[model samples]
Target: MKPHSLTDRPATLNSRYNRLALVSSPRHLALLNKEDADTLVVICDWLLWQSAVTDGWHCVHFETALIDNHAPDPLDMDIMLRANDWVWLDGVDHTLFHGVSLGRQFCSTAQYIVSAYYRMDLALRKLLSEFSCREVTLYDYWVDRYLVSPDLRHLIVATVARDMGVHFDDQLDPVLPGDPALAAAPSTLGAPPTGWHKLAKQCGLALHGYAMTVMVAVQRRLRPRVNRPLVIANWNMVRSFLQSDPADDCQPMVLAPTLPKTLNLLRRFWSANILPCPYPSVGLTQQEREQIAAMVKVYEAHWSEPAEGLEEAMRRFMRASVLTLDNLLPLARQVKSVQAFLRRYRPSRIVVDGVKSPPLSIFLELGKAQGIPADYIWHSPLAPQNIRFDNLGCESRQEALVERCLSWGKFNDMWLERIGAACSSVRVGNPVLAKYTAMKKSGGGRDVALLLQLVPAFSDVRGLYLSQYEFFVEGVRQLNQLGYKRVIFKMHPSMWREEYYEEIARRFELKVEIRKHGRFEDYVREADLVVGPMVSGAMLEVLASGTPMVAYFLKPSTLDSTYFDGLNVQSDISRLGEAVTNNEFLDPAVVLDLYCDSECGQSPAERFWQALSRSPL
Candidate 1:
């Protein structure tokens, strides 16, 4: 069955149910994103249209991924008002997380995933008791919070999975030890997909970051006041911010999600050597902690115990739930906390990172209200994506939100067109990558850098809308057949095994080596040609660094209209080997067009600082 589209849902609602909650169907969830304004408009438009025709029953929509902790876009707010909605609940961003049983205790992808929503469930019940909701109707699917029945026990209508013959399972199934067993290191290449669940196991040190999460939560807790600073959102922005010249005298105070994995990456800044200067944290404050603790207490009071083996795990899950969902009061407290932090620190400017958490939009909202200069950053490239730029996509909303933008060179014109010439845009090649790609020395060897993504979403719909991991066996097969002897497999940080390259070599019988340790510049310095999927920002940086590139996509239908006209790109999943062997993407002239809009003679870091420095204090 096709995923639910605007025209695909049932035309009318059943009058039997008065209070209805329109939870995002998988199809709708797949199409909508909290960060994209146009996506929000499209989704809200559909929900409002549903509300328009419905009878006496008042309806609310639950996106589950959005935490609209502050004022929304006027138009989006208007639509939601017309639709009369709930929201993408805070701490309940189920789209990116799941509950995993680690030993006797349980943990989630982030502290705010499936576990917390369960606690919020009881809170929701308590709140619902105040209303006259006899039997609430839900319009969602099994893909939402793993346990979503208690809140909407009336009816679950319009789930796409049900049409496809998948039954809803409510069991809080614990992840077994080595349950997603390692893919057989393939002796001779005769195997099928190892099933979806098995292929979706946590790669490496997923849970190990818990300690760091706590440590940072305590050590760099939010301060009442920070020294002269520039406020940035998410760890990715911090990564880019610190990559510039320290003498430039810019201190970055980052607002990051307090999650284990994120905390682990943030802790690495001490010795990163990439940072020319020090940065501060945006972790929870004492008040915020107290509020969170109280929320946990109230949430736990409701769902105190669980069945059998899930006792301790369920308790942790509840704690984790409040850590993620829309408990309103605590989130409002967090907003106050941010307000206090901003008032005290008074960052020279506020930057809203679009690629990071959606609530970070709060920063932009606050910036606009307080007369502080706030801007947005695309922070990456967009090609080989499901989004079609030449035809339609929702990125233009970002261009409208900010007065100025810091973007990749190749995409500047697109943003200008999307937002119009009124918005000033600087074609700053990704500063983080620019710092990494610095010191690139020309090499006289024939070696290739093949990037491997974790989940290839175009090829597999089960994964999130991200692509990076497809190459490896297929790419190596192609390159080796093309007589390229030396190849380096740069593993994404999310990969679990340290010896993953060795595993690849052993499994696929290739002459490829893994460059496990080194900065990106080190790898770039050693390679003659950079070959990877076009969907990555790093590849663009490689092109800007005067290196030739060949970008691979799964198929032509999945390819977006890339930036350049004569760019070296091939989209043939069936004959990837032929595409690589024939040098279908080999070009030096294409690199000229790539860096043209990506960067100027000035370093990206300098350019970014200049963009932020546009409106002076």
Candidate 2:
């Protein structure tokens, strides 16, 4: 049956059993038929609207159903890997960013829209299967409104319904008083900066790029034949260098698009060869703009339902791909600028966090062209098998960009080998771990630091809201029962939802301290025990700090099975207090040996430098 929109006929709540009504926007409850059902399945942060709905309605929350750990979900990854057709146009390969087929980037950007469509489809199917319901009535404005772009909302909702064979109701009628104008399409491609703000940013970037280029020229003249390794530094690299005391010989010139405050500190103390590679607002040539427009047309018109299902949705997804091509013009500009910089100065080597990123890979490719070998430092903890490393289908194609990978330790090296990463792996250890190893451990106490992972609501990270809810509400309740008098709630560095944490704290009536700032190491040293409910590299860092750590999760993850294999990983929130009490933490030395490979004589920074020196191009 075809989907139906609202009419003058008012929809009334039905009390029939086995009937389910999934509500994305519940404001117009008067218009909802409730599927002539006994249940109301509220998707995405249902807790906020739970009290408003009818009592005794069986509700399944969106977050609770899908467990997200910030890492790529298996389903999401499968969706990404399933498509090879979207990038092909006519006979030639349209799957390229600059001169390379950046298949991973293209798929990932397409997924920003398509994944949401498929996920909603999955959610509906799952709900029907669990409830044993024949038909599901959808009251959704969430897709229509909350999506990053406006044009894709109706398309996604309609596509999802048809794909699932569910009776789709477009929207509830008798609009809520203050609801946003549904017809208004805000610029799908984000609004560029206007007036003085735009001008200032452009001028700043241009000046910074020129200044860095001049500095490199002067440095080349002053110290001929010096081994100047150019570092395409991100925050992680800057933080690593900041923590470690690098030798004079190991200093690499830093090149970043934007300089965080920490980089300024690094420049003052460490090396002054820091420059901003002007990426944003790069002046694109007319030819490049025309090329992007042409590519957009091809991608927009192209549609192939890969054998992976979601056939009807792929068409809209292809159209959505047009929006992401905005990056193409900027990428071309970046590549041109980088080529000039690399050719002029001729850095001895290129150092970056990873070779997988499209932007970072540009540096690697350019460096390779100029005979400058690239070295990628293992920045984060190696995630476990299946969900992360396995089934990517693209890493094998991209790994050749880097000449060598400076790994964290044996586990990373082994995993890299297992995954068939083309680069040779060297266990140079991590500077952050080395520093953590020397830190004075906190004295035994009941105080616990709970690391929170709070992803933005309705984002690609599925079930993230549920993860936060369980981490805060359920986790705090469990801690209180255990008689843990003082609990410090450490917000994820990327988030600052103190108001949400405070609200949860007030509800629990527990003595909780919400910490929005402070390094991960600082939290480990201050608390007697570190408990991270979400998957994080900091958990590995906690292991190196000699502090007892409990990896808590609502469901078993790759991290639980692999990294913290023998350690205390509690999936049962109720048993968390017991696990904390038992405190059978992993031995720091063994953990260090496996993950960090710490050296007694030399620092990790020094070790990495030595490894780089040993590995000749």
Candidate 3:
């Protein structure tokens, strides 16, 4: 089946696919160099008519000179691609061109939006809502336009962020005074010894992915980037979670990153060379710094609820930062720094585990333009109709989006169908799962593990589990009553620091092992039974491990009806104690059918080679 060209498309196309191809042609990058700006007229016209977003856009041409003073906006790029009233200048603007006066003329027939004023200049944004409706904001386009095309990629624009860019909206902690989790970060500024040569060497390693003189895309000082050299660009904890601890020098291997440890040892396997990614500190303009500082107040209102507010607030912040041009100065500088870092690395292929982050969305798009292949390895199963909310109120019943999506379970039927709808996904099993193996049988242990989700800071509220704080706390109490000696409460990484875990464990007198990091596989493997939230990706890992597991849905929604309606999943936590002690929950075999077929019974390298063979690379 041919993709819809610039002219003709179905009135209704799959939104997920629309998300993949924000711009009609990947060749848009090639046209960027053309001397004539008129070439963009065609592109803009095509975007005005053919783009995926239906809300329509108010297109305005920004001066190219802004690139020097302004930042590269991944979000604004989405707006230009999606709007019907799309505007672009015939030539680059040497002077500022406020789109407000132009918006009134073009939007007479259009709906009202609040954020549109932020679209042009931050100074000009206060003049918004003088015209236009309230149902919309300035723009809400996505930043993953070029993320779908691997063949179009020549570079991999990615990052390895340690902090994960999280900050609380409030100055003071309401629950815990100076929450141990809020410990002051050690100053990293100018912390390294002022040695020019070492800094230069670090620069070379980061910029070129190899030694200074090396021109190849995959040359690292520690290892060579050969046969799909894997460059790990972590937006979250993926790097630490997936990468082998340097202390684990039990086996000598090239690059010494863990993926090749077991599977590659079985055969002369083609594993990627792990590049050393250093955390970079780029300077921010004073204006950019101030704008970012003000975000705390703005976000505090957007996310006022407790039980999972911080995560939702963080998510809201990212979406606003990445999806709207409301404030692009900081984001722009960040992108420039990211691009410079990635270009220095010159990576051939990129590997991502778990879901994509909003902050990284721009990098992935940039990678596609450079022709780098990114392998998105999700932690859990991708439901055909995965729930996505408008705001952070994922638990709020009113927050449900009524838009149509592709029918559920269609992707599982065909091999090519998976991730082919938009982004290219590989079923390499869950990286978190790969770390686990059966620890004998459940009979030897009377322990149970309750894997927690985001709450008290922000609610992920997947399926039936809404209040992760209340649900998991009660879950532990119930499991404890069931005569389980150890109800190991796996702490969420966002919630748990090493010190915080010890404090919570001691303070609550909670007789459970509070793990701060990726020891989930170890605990799940050791536990007699594993119970998780209503809809967690970790379910596949538990099910595949041959562990007796149950999905505890508090509200008993569609997921329970589809996978475990009749099965022994405990929809009622009241019955959890009776069911678990009596061995009445789901058997591993019944849940195995949901596993990504190629991922089952395979190592990451084994499954990766199979995926690469089938990939265009």
Top candidate, metric TM-score: 2
* Model 2, span 488-575: residue lDDT tens: 7887643234565575566546567888777776777777766664345676677777777776544423222555566455666546
- The root-mean-square deviation over C-alpha atoms between each candidate and the true structure, in angstroms, is 16.6, 7.3, 21.2
Better of 1 and 2 by TM-score: 2
Each candidate: how many clashes? 18, 0, 29
- Per-residue CA lDDT of candidate 3, range 1-617, in tens? 11123223334322221011112232332323323222221121112222322322221212111112233332222221112122222322111111111111211112112122222222111111211111111111111111111211100101001122211111110112232332211223344645897898667445543331242223344354334333343322243233332211111122222232233322222133223343244666677556545444443444356322222322333344332344444455555555665566555554443222323333444555576655444434444223222111222221211111211122333322421233333444433444443343544356565545422111111121123333544566677777787777776554234453344345445566666567666666677777775355566566656676657654412121354455565655556677666777565554544444422454443444344342322
Candidates ranked by TM-score: 2, 1, 3
lDDT of 1 by residue, 1-617 (tens): 11122213333323233232333333333333333221111111222323322421222223212222122222221211111111112323221111110110111122222223322332234323333233332333222123333322212222211332323333222222121222211113335446674455343233443443444344334322322334454455566655553322443444433322444455554333121122223445566555545544454454455332223333443444433445434344445556665675567666655522324544554555677665666655543233321101133222223555566565554644542234566566556554534555554345565544433432221222111222455666666666666777775444233353464456446777766456666676666666776556566566545565567654212223445456656654336656545656545334433543432566665666655553322
In candidate 3, stretches whose alpha carbon ends up further than 4 angstroms from where it belongs are 1-330, 341-351, 354-359, 371-375, 380-385, 388-420, 423-428, 438-444, 447-466, 496-518, 556-567, 598-604, 613-617
What's the lDDT for candidate 3? 0.36
Q: Per-residue lDDT for 358 in model 1?
A: 28
Least well predicted 10-residue stretch by lDDT in candidate 1: 97-106
Q: Per-residue error at 40 for model 2, in Å?
A: 4.6
